[model samples]
Target: MARELLPGQSPELLKALHILTRDGALNADSLRKLKQVNHLVRLLAPAIEDVLARFGDPVLVDCGAGKSYLGFVLHELFLRPAGKGSLHAVEARPELVAAAEALAARLGADRMRFERAAIDAAAPPARVHLVTALHACDTATDDALALAVRHGADHVAVVPCCQAEVARQLGEAAAPAPLLAPLFEHPWHRREFGSHLTNVVRALALRASGYAVTVTELAGWEHSLKNELILGRKVRASDRAAEDRLLGLCAAAGIRPKIVRLLFPAGAPAP
Candidate 1:
């Protein structure tokens, strides 16, 4: 049963995305979905405003946009007639891409475009002002973050999922058998360790690449276990010491990332 959305409470785009259902009522699933989107929007609001102030009509790209839930909800709630910004969604899944495209068309959201592409390989339009990736898996989040850094995005928002890459890296590093053997044996332990290591490296990498990073819990844990949202802004330059340390961590883990070098040219000092 779908309950009607409260007046002035639900965003039309969210309704179309099925977060509100046909009747607008939010169920247990819808409630979780809404919380995630709402948290992201709140975090990005100030950054979006700042970008708009600088670049008349900012362009935003959503990578790994699984069904484009963020895109639809954002457009409905924030983007307006007076706002000339557009949202381009990059999704690898063909069905999701098609569904998102149809939904955008049905809603007359001319500014929204959905394309099929992996996060690592996505080529966005020239001059993107913002880049967002919600629940992008493992290194895919890094891929999206790399894109944001390369494109000089005014802002970037990411909620990461599945830290397998980092876990693998962590596993390769030598540690006491008594402590580390258990992590490798237990699925939950591996996931917890990997999640922590992934975010720590990511924050350091962003700082090394000239972005100020802020990490916070996105909504509540009930929304999802992958609830950490890392918000990055290009208000400051990179730090050479941080860059060295970041590279050192990769070296220590024996995993060579494609982003470190691209973001920090010649290992130059932070400007």
Candidate 2:
């Protein structure tokens, strides 16, 4: 059962996080959850290391921290060992925040802190190195991205969950191209198409705001249905060409994603 814990992760910590059973055995669901976080941490290693090297004390913020599992695991596997970085988990739930803070205290994770705040309202450190949101439902993910941009974060990694706005809008939307209506003409297709389209808009929005983005899978479909991973690295202040593409894409779809309105104000200059 000790092997059920991730390397460098203490059994006590995993048990506290409820990722490991009381007896230290990992159920299938727990193992899948661990795998997802493991892959994300590995994928984010280079970015974290680069920030630590340059900033000396990098600040990493995790929004919509359900159960704060990612925050705990990331702190244990990355920040605790690095000794020059801190992680702030922003979660609206008072219970989760309290639990995470209590766990941090137990582990002597002095660098870890939990704040009770919504994704959109949370204020991160002045100089944020990285921002992460795992499985932030619907528009909450957009709020996290907006927070990152406002703070001028160096990197952003998010695994969005439950994209429903675009899908709901599509129910009443008439495709700009009549031939394209089949993409979302039915209820099932609309949900699926809306999720895909929402991610595309988000990526373009990031690119327009100066991030070089890569969209890929977070983990296998079997591990989680909400598996789309969007990684962004800040490259410059802005990309006007990308902004044009993003705006044009929204116009064509007749739907403005939350990211579009969040990142791009009406007639506002691109950042």
Candidate 3:
């Protein structure tokens, strides 16, 4: 009897992706990796369908694309079948970008392209339909969100990792809200509270910039510690209430993150 794979899931592509061994065997680690990305693809299916239904040809970007695994999987599961859009993988490392480009060619994924860019400097495609960042560390996730907002992207999804920037600032800054100072006065509490606050601020910032945000778990804790997924869909021009909330949160917390600076530089409105 032949081994069974998911429907329309190509073993050859999986082998090329190293998700499966050359002889088509799935290792323990590879299985875990595939499961994470596969689940994200499933979560994003509705957004893909919505963009395809609304637009003739869409452009999707993956920011801080490490090896472009998510990019390739997304293209394979969505763009390739539709044959109507492109997946642009943005990575800072030249070597990873080169390798991903070669892999795309080998897989005959002509529509998937690679670009070398820092998350903050990533250029927008002609029109951006979707933007995603997986495990982008520290403030890089903020850069990805800024990119999406600048382009007014139809959808945004990010799984942030190691939000150290806020934690570091929390240690140095005095709490404007005296009652809440206890939340981060200790080292352990500072780390945990800072991480939680970072995500909340991000969600509020997205809302301020006209996106309806959803925060959820990306996967089980066993799969990855960085499992928090922030998803957003464009809904309006902007929400001043959300903007005020974001401003108040930052002021009370006594921390101004990169996203706040990018979106509201010098206390001016977003462009």
Candidate 4:
């Protein structure tokens, strides 16, 4: 006898994703990974539904899409049910892109397409309704955010991972902020502070770009170390005060000019 399937989940889809074996059996590890992916999809479901309600045929771009697990699960659970929408999975690895493309074709996921491209270089044909970056490492997450903002995505969901940029910036600082000097004295503290500061700057940047930003734990710490989930919904007006605070934070941390320019462009108000 075969094991029971999750509601609304296709056995074929699971097998194609390799979450299930050829014999349609799942081990403990596969089940745990699937649960994690499902949890992430649930977190973004409300936002996706909102976009679908507003736009009849929504488009979603997934940056640094890796093996395209999130893209596949999202299409399976949401877009396929609606019988509309498209998902573009952008990955730098040719093999991963080819595999994803083949799997999508086999699954008859005609609306899904996999592209071989980096997050910084991906040029969407049109503005997308939603953007997602799951565990996009270091500056790749920033690249994804920049892409989303540039394309004017309606909703952005990102789970940043391995944020080394801020830590490196902190280490290169000629003079650390007086208030934060003690925290930066130790390597471990510097790593933790860098992670926190990176998220803060990112949230502020999104706010500066006219997004209502929310930061929450993506999952329990025990389950994943990279658990911070940042959700952003585009708004009509940008928050000048948040931008101002972001600038002040940068100055205090003695961030490099390049990073400042990347996060807050010139010709933007004095803030």
Better of 3 and 4 by lDDT: 3
Worst 10 residues of 2 by lDDT: 262-271
Which pairs clash (backbone N, Cα, C closer than 3 Å) in model 4? none
Off by over 4 Å in 2: 1-7, 221-223, 267-271
Q: lDDT tens digits, residues 173-202, model 3?
A: 764589778899999999999999999989
Could you tell me which 10 consecutive residues in candidate 3 have the lowest summed lDDT?
A: 1-10
For model 1, how many clashes?
Answer: 3
- Candidate 1 local lDDT, 53-137, one digit each (tens): 7777788899899999888766765565436788889999999999989988888877787879997788887678999998887
Model 4 C-alpha lDDT per residue in residues 137-207, reported as the tens digit of each score: 78888888888887889999999888887777788787767987787778898899888888888888899
lDDT values of the candidates?
A: 0.74, 0.83, 0.84, 0.81
Worst 10 residues of 1 by lDDT: 1-10
162-254: candidate 2 lDDT, tens digit per residue? 889988877766554566677888899989989999889899889999999999886645546798889999999999999998887666666
Off by over 4 Å in 4: 1-7, 256-260, 267-271
Would you give me the overall lDDT of model 2? Answer: 0.83
Q: Could you tell me the lDDT of residue 129 within candidate 3?
A: 91
* Clash count in backbone of candidate 3: 0
Residue 43 local lDDT, model 3? 87
In order of appearance, the predictions have TM-scores of 0.84, 0.92, 0.94, 0.91
